[model samples]
Target: MALEFSPETYKKFEETVNRYPKKEAALLPVLCLAQKEFGHLGQEAIEYVARLMEQSPARVCGVVSFYTMLNTKPIGWHHIQVCRTLPCALRGAERLTSFISKTLGIEVGQTTADGRFTLSEVECLASCGTAPMMQINDDYYENLTDEKVTEVLASLK
Candidate 1:
């Protein structure tokens, strides 16, 4: 089926649009709704959102490419994002990421064969104090050790 939001999502989108003085201001939230419905914002979805917002496809694509939170391709069910910023790096985030890659048998930016997890090396998760953290889907697992990371992955499985 073609990518489109549900009727309920359209209602939410309308409400979001009303919240903003300009329809362009609603682009991000509408794009978010489109992504949630379609799982990823491919070319089709990007253009769809652009037309809905009365904006150019290039403009929409630019926004999608600029944001780390936005994805242009399919990701696994559990998107594991490891923070590699200065604070996280100082706290062994790289080692932790390596451990996860080894454990999952998939390198960063690759999804596992089973389609259960996608590992991504991201910039920062804003958890500087709780460094060495990886976000699984929406939940953050912090202060990771090999054993703890293993336990977390096993629990998800």
Candidate 2:
């Protein structure tokens, strides 16, 4: 399809642009729309978005890479990002991440063969006070234990 978004997406992009004082300000929202429609901001999609926004690919690429929320590769139905910074690490985030990988039979940055789950080791989820945090989809789990993670995964269909 030569890297194109739906007409509806384009319409929304226009509306988003109109909402902002500067078209460049629409970058984030339009990029968000691109992610929603494409599921990731890989090279092809980044190029397309840059073209849509009249931006250089380098500019758009930087934006995509800056956000952990943006995916550059295909992911699973469930995206699990475990915080691996100091606090979470001390709280056993590494163990929890290892546990999730072992339990799920897929390592970090890899999706299950069935595409059910993807595990990532992120820098910080901004929940140091809670420690040992993991963000599954939009929900965050803090104070993690192997048993807790097992239970959480079990509940997923």
Best by lDDT: 1
Q: Quote the lDDT for 82 in model 2.
A: 95
TM-score of each: 0.94, 0.88
Clashes of each: 0, 0
lDDT values, one for every candidate? 0.90, 0.89
lDDT of 2 by residue, 21-133 (tens): 88888898888899889988889999999998899999999988887778889889889999999999888888888899999999899999998899998888888999898
The segments of candidate 1 whose C-alpha lies over 4 angstroms from its true place after superposition are: none
For candidate 2, which ten residues in a row score worst on lDDT? Answer: 63-72
Over 1-157, each residue of candidate 1 has an lDDT whose tens digit, in order, gives: 7767789988988998999999999999898888888899999999889988999999999999987778899999999898999999998999999999999999988998888999998888888888889888889999888898999999988
Error of 2 at 129 (Å): 2.4
Clashing pairs in 2: none
